[model samples]
Target: MEEALPIRKIIHVDMDAFYASVEQLDNPELRGKAIAVGGSSKRGVVAAASYEARKFGVRSAMSSVLAKKMCPHLIFVKSNFDRYRELSQRIRNIFFEYTDLVEPLSLDEAYLDVTENKKGNPSATLIAQEIRQKIKEKTSLNASAGISTNKFIAKVASDINKPNGQKTVPPEAVLGFLENLEIKKFYGVGKVTKEKMYRHGIFTGKDLKAKPLEYLQEHFGKSGSYYYHVVRGIHNSAVKPTRTRKSLAAERTFSENISSEVYMLERLETIAEEVERRLTKNNVAGKTITLKIKYSDFTLQTRSKTLPFYISSKSLMLDAVKDLLFQEKMKNSVRLLGISLSNLNNEKKEQQPEPEESIDVQLKFDF
Candidate 1:
């Protein structure tokens, strides 16, 4: 008889209404009211919404104006990223206590591989509960958790009982759980894919599994293979520990759209300076500089230029963006201007001292 694979235990944790909830927690007056966290201006986008606000059809990334029209009395609170990051670090510290195999997806969510934990605890479900309870105690915030044998199912399972709850899918029950899941609930199946699946009569996981592999691959291309295995409970993606910062960027949406070349040049110089500052603060330099422009109509475009050597100085970065901006005439009035530095090479990682709070840790376990 052949030996079986070791079943890995995974947990996905997501904070409820992170930014909006934090606002409410910090300010007692904001509680029990429909509130959103974002700029309140006409062009401002919603970053998050409280549960009460969500009931009013308000959502993140929607224009502030639309959100207001949806909820006439929606309270808008400006974002406090510094405060959010502090809480995020605290949450991450809690995760590190359980296992070093913690992968943070954002300031409010993470995936943890607790199969072999520092506490020597065997039940991932119990660990998740402990973590959620601790988060509530330490930060006065509620978090939901999903426990499963792999990251894919854990990510989906986390949503079963959202906003201060958890769900678990054991290895033996994984197939049964996936079978009844709706196609819309699948991670990669977005609005477009959901519509396509519905048109093809693939409304549920069972419907997806019934389709032939060749038919799926032909219809969905590379993603078809992904769906074919994931719906059948075959995802084996590991919980990666190391997350490299891929790029350093800074951008701003203007209060008003403008088209003048002279005005744009001035804005690019300012944005480039901010990018340079972030690159310097992060102790990274890059060979590629990308210029992003968002037109008034919301259409976006980017142009990148690669230098022969890495550059992080404000002047060098400004020169590159200036050229990219002036290289083409205005297509439409520009509403947003941004600069990003990519192909990052961190020289300080080896040649110089690390940042005061910098930590690079990895652990290995018996497989």
Candidate 2:
């Protein structure tokens, strides 16, 4: 007889409108009001939107101008990242109380593996509820969660209920849950992939499962395999406690397009300084420096150079950026400028993988 595979319990916790919620939490008057956390200037983008603002079609990454137009009464508040980070740390501390196997996706969201946890809890559903409640008690913020056997399903389930609620896809329900899920709601399917899936008559998990692996690979390339297994509830990704930072960058979008090389260099100097400060804070340096340019027509161009040694100083970074800047003439007036550093000295070395355990067991557990 074959040994039964261990069914790990995973939970994905996502704070509700984190940045905007922080703004609202700090200012009682801002509560229950439509607000956006970002500049309301012409070039400003919405960093986050309150649930009230979301009802008006204001969303993060939307232009502030459009956000205001969408909700004329929308109030714009400047972002307070320091406060956000402090509260995020508080929330993360709560997760550590239950399990050290926590993987933070961002300041507002994380994946927690609690199959065998400090609390000795076997019910991931109850664990998720406790975490959410503790986050509220500690930070006065609302959080939603998804509980499931894998990270992908847990992540998708987390969004089923918004603003302080959770959903658990138990082992027995995983297949049916995924089959009925909208193709767009699959964790990895973005607008482009959704359209491609639509073109291929893949409208939902069931539709995707209907195609053979070879057919999927022929059309979707490497990702076809990913779609194939995830829909069948075969995702086995572990919840890693620590994730390495791949790159560091800083950028600014101008209020007006500037074509002069001197002006561009002036802006690049400031951007490089910001990047250097971030690198110093992270205590890492990089060999590759890239200069990103966005033209008035919204076209982007990037130039990079790699050095023999890692350098994090603004002076060194600016020197490389200047070469890349002058290497090519301005295709058009520039609207945005950015500096990024890759090939960092702190990159993690690859480790050999262990074979994955099967997820083929019938899960009768409760969330």
Candidate 3:
């Protein structure tokens, strides 16, 4: 038999509690303090909570009222999407410098394929270290990175050490790691799934892997095949880049609702800057600009402009954004403001050229 194929190296990079951490980093007073990003009212949910607040049992998706009850001195601030997006762009630029095969899970997380990287480095562990260092140096932020032979293992490795941590799962160690891992800790195995697994005495990765394929299929349905492969440390997913812009948007909701158009414009300026950076990064022009407004009561409205020609420059894009903003009729005082650009060009071919296709005739067999 022929030799087996070499393993592909993958890395998963995730920022630590991105929004809350950024807020704490910007305002030194908030450091080591319990802080949550959301409303203090009954209707609000916690978008993010600082590490300090987490110590009080506060978490994302929990009610702000409950969070406040847990930590009486909790600081509640509204979401600042503009600032978050700006920081996310800077992080993306850093990822591009290392390898272009980056698949962004969201603004705060991404998977990078570095089997044949530009750094000429043989160790994936070193690449993870370098990327983490660059993110901290450039953004003053902490990121957790996981390096492994594939996405499944790589993603799990990243979370092993969080908050400015990096870890690697070498191919030789994968079996031992998987065998000892708690079943509940496996990706996609949520509380409900874990409960069912517990009822069936499947408490570890080894337990799941030892089960008959048919038994797993009978219980977990189609995902049984997926679990089987993952437990065996075999994943086939490739790092795909299919980011097409159906729309580009920048939005911000304030801590306190205000009716002042002057204050709204100031906020809009920051939002416009973020949109410009994204447009420039994609090298695409937009023909339509939309302005979104959310009133104090949470009612929303929008005014849009479809330009004669596509434009992406900072000044031109901001002008269209301003025009859209000015055209909207104010009702009950705006609490949130946003700007978006759409109708982008998808034909830019400056980055990579088309590869020639070939058809081979011979298939050699060693019998």
Candidate number with greatest lDDT:
2
Candidate number achieving the greatest TM-score relative to the actual structure: 2
Task: Write candidate 3's Cα lDDT for 1-367 as tens digits.
Answer: 8554445779999999898999998899888889999888876889999888999999998878899999999999888989999999999888888788998988899999888788877777888899889999999999999987778888888889987898888777777788899998888888888999998889999999899878988999977767877787767677766655667788887778877777877888889888888888777778888888988776778888899998877678777766776675677877678888887776443322111110011011110
Q: Ranking under lDDT, best-scoring first?
A: 2, 1, 3
Lowest lDDT sum, 10 consecutive residues, model 1, at 357-366
Q: Model 3 compared with the native: what TM-score?
A: 0.67
**Candidate 2 TM-score, true structure as reference:** 0.86
Candidate 2 runs further than 4 Å off: 1-4, 285-290, 299-331, 343-345, 348-358, 362-366
TM-score of each: 0.82, 0.86, 0.67
Compose the digit string of candidate 2's lDDT tens values, residues 158-222. 99998799999988888899999999999999988999999999898999989998999899997
- Per model, how many backbone clashes are there? 0, 1, 0
Candidate 2 — what's its lDDT? 0.90
